[model samples]
Target: MNFYKNNEMVPMTRRYPDLKDKVKKRDNKISIQLIRAWDVERDAEKVLKIFLQNIDKLSSYRYWELLRSVWIICGTVENAQFFSSLMKSNKPNRHYFSTPEEHEFLRSLPDQMDVYRACNSPQDGGISWTLDYDYACKYAKDFQKNMVLNNKINKSEVFAYINRNNESEILIL
Candidate 1:
């Protein structure tokens, strides 16, 4: 993880004497621009592997949330380019982003990122579903009913979905 220092960040362990060996105290700022003006530091998991490193502690259902959070953080064109630059140097690890088309589809629409986690649960749990494809389709159809129109979305063919406190809805184009 990286640390914020002197209005900039350096590798925590090597550069920040105060944060040495204090992994929990480290700030994982991937983008200085992304930091809010009120908050100079941000704990972006994408830039650092520490917070999500406790994979054993997470239930199987929460895996998708973790993956989605990572993708959302590091799946930008510049981030992809940076990762590619590392690759050219034969770096051991790399990250990738979706194509513009795929990314646009995602950001422009409402996303049910935790559908996988919601699979095979009761309605009271809010959006619980069977993992089977047929059941998933039915859930989608039912979920579609709760959406409201927004942007280019139409009620008939949804482009976005918003689940309001357990009740679901979809908006279509």
Candidate 2:
């Protein structure tokens, strides 16, 4: 689980475009083990096991990055807790924020925010939403049926605010 340190904060999307746009499906067993490993407190052994078992599929660095994306994409309370535990562990990939500024930015958001999303259906709601209306429009252009969705949400409801992508994404569980 090697995390490459960057001189500047680069969005995870830039580093791994597939994380957001075209995530490859994982084996159910691999997915389950990943959840189990992170779900437990400091279960380094489980994390290591998954890495070793899937070495042929991904490098350690990419594996951890994929996990980071999954954490954000899932936007579940359990996944959030798992990631928090992972950050506290002694693993080489414990680094969560690219910089202190990134951390501070997330902490400094207002108590309430207007968030938006672009999806295929009006009823479609997902964990990921942007704070920028223009960016939401950018996403809406992707599909003929895509519609822009917006809502005002309390800060407490935001599962994560990742400015690394410069998208002002707010993940709600």
Write down the TM-score of every candidate: 0.22, 0.48
lDDT of each: 0.31, 0.57
TM-score winner among the candidates? 2
Give per-residue CA lDDT, model 2, range 51-147, as digits (tens): 5577456433455554554444444433445555543434443234233455466568888889988777655445667888987887677545457
- lDDT by residue for model 1 over 6-125, one digit each (tens)? 233212121222333333222333222233411444545423353245434332222223333343344333354443332233221111122233333445544333222122323222
Model 2 earns a TM-score of 0.48
Candidate 1's C-alpha runs over 4 A off are 1-40, 45-47, 77-173
* lDDT of model 2 at position 101: 51
Error of 1 at 91 (Å): 26
Top-lDDT structure, candidate number: 2
Lowest lDDT block of 10, candidate 2: 13-22
